[model samples]
Target: MPFGGEPPQLLKQRLLYQGRRFSFESSRLRLPNEQEGEWECIRHPGGALAVPVTPEGKLILLRQYRFTVQGRLLEFPAGTVEPSEGPEETIKREIEEETGYRAHRWRKLGEYFMAPGYSDEIIYAYLAEDLELLENPPGQDIDEDIETTLMTVEEVDRAIHSGDLADAKSISAFMLARPFLK
Candidate 1:
């Protein structure tokens, strides 16, 4: 652990709701400062993302509709880490399904927490290169409304700066893969 610390003393814990991808929980605990309170959080299986690059030096992205936000967001190909699967496996499957491309080379970017205040969702990110488009690509899930898009490195940076691409994980992962980009 990098910045390790003793966890709060848990007094009681209860599961509030269990969904397909995550669960909600409430806990009563005494903090290190000796203060006691009830806290709620979301427990997730984690997520994996791939920043796929083409031989033409363009990045593959998506305009995805998220019902919660009631709009489309620009994002990289990603999926939840399923049981018994590594992060790499999750992203590998997702990249193909979402983008219709398979990557011959991969480089691990890094992992980071999405929201510490309410959820324990860590996003494992990777840089995917040497992509080959599949003739018979596996389609996306029925519920996903996604459109594949390609952009240059500068375009992505401008989108981030202009608030056009507001997805946090996408922005973070792009910054991580930036130094290696040509």
Candidate 2:
């Protein structure tokens, strides 16, 4: 039988937990190979990210703290897709809120699965150019610990090569935006 059993049938499903950004779900399934088991995954509303490029060729990034990782990681401005917002709106709002910059030109790079192994979260990535720095940037969320910075393309590549930038979503989005980076 093919993988996923031609879209596996949902035998039973339960909501394990429901959080602000995502929910945990456990599903019991019967595979094509006659295997029956329960699989747990995170059900996220999805996310949107932007690779902001300054006119002088700098990239905007954030060193944000993640409780799960217990350290700050370099990341692009991104946000979870709110129920009333699309990916574009999410990125547009997130860029200003997180990076204090607004982009007049936007080229959608692409979308990808963030962690297919345990999450159904897909991230929509965009290339944001023609940037303008907001004089009075919006205040970040009280729960967020983020510090924004600017780096050259070469600097970002170096950071990635040296594992200083370890955000998978940012790395994947950068790869998608590579052609426009130089």
Candidate 3:
């Protein structure tokens, strides 16, 4: 047939790695069109990002070393949403925990599926304003070494133009928040 028959349907799923906070699952599916007849998939919980803006039109960003990417990257403060937590609440908590800043105003910017071809991770982006600095908590994740900085909108624009700020999440958030800029 031109449509190549119906796509595969999930048949079974089992957890591969179950951490204290998150779990990864392996799934089994049956494909009618494929001669092999069966396939496997990985399931993962998604993450969230907070694009914090200062009153002076600067964006609060984080610089950290990512082991997977094997480099330091500049990005907005972000984290995975804990179970039973809403996106706004997760963003608020993540911004404070990572950047030592609390936002008074929060606006839902947008959402995106990060690599829908392979993973089912959905990222929720938010715009935060009216920031106040606070003391950072100790015993943060050992692998997390983050430094916070504020960049003007013009600076961000320049980075995007020059191919400096190339992170997908950062680029998406900046584009989504462009209408709010002066």
Candidate number of the best lDDT: 1
Q: Residue pairs in steric clash, candidate 3?
A: none
lDDT of 3 by residue, 34-88 (tens): 4333333334466789889877878988887888789878898888777788777
List the candidate numbers ranked by TM-score, top first. Answer: 1, 2, 3
RMSD of each: 1.0, 2.4, 4.4
lDDT over C-alpha atoms for residue 63 of model 2: 97
Could you give candidate 1's per-residue lDDT for residues 80-163 as a string of tens digits? 999989999999999999999999999999999999899999999999999999999999999999999999999999999999
Candidate 2 lands at a TM-score of 0.94
Instruction: Show how many residue pairs clash in every candidate, following the order shown.
Output: 0, 0, 0
TM-score of 1: 0.97
Candidate 2 lDDT over 1-182, as tens digits, reads 12342667789999989998899999999887778999999999999999999999999999999999999989999999999999999999999999999899999999999899999899999999999999998868889999999999999999999999999999999999999888
- TM-score on alpha carbons, each prediction: 0.97, 0.94, 0.81
lDDT of 1 at 77: 97
Model 3, runs deviating above 4 Å: 1-8, 14-40, 135-140
Which candidate leads in TM-score?
1
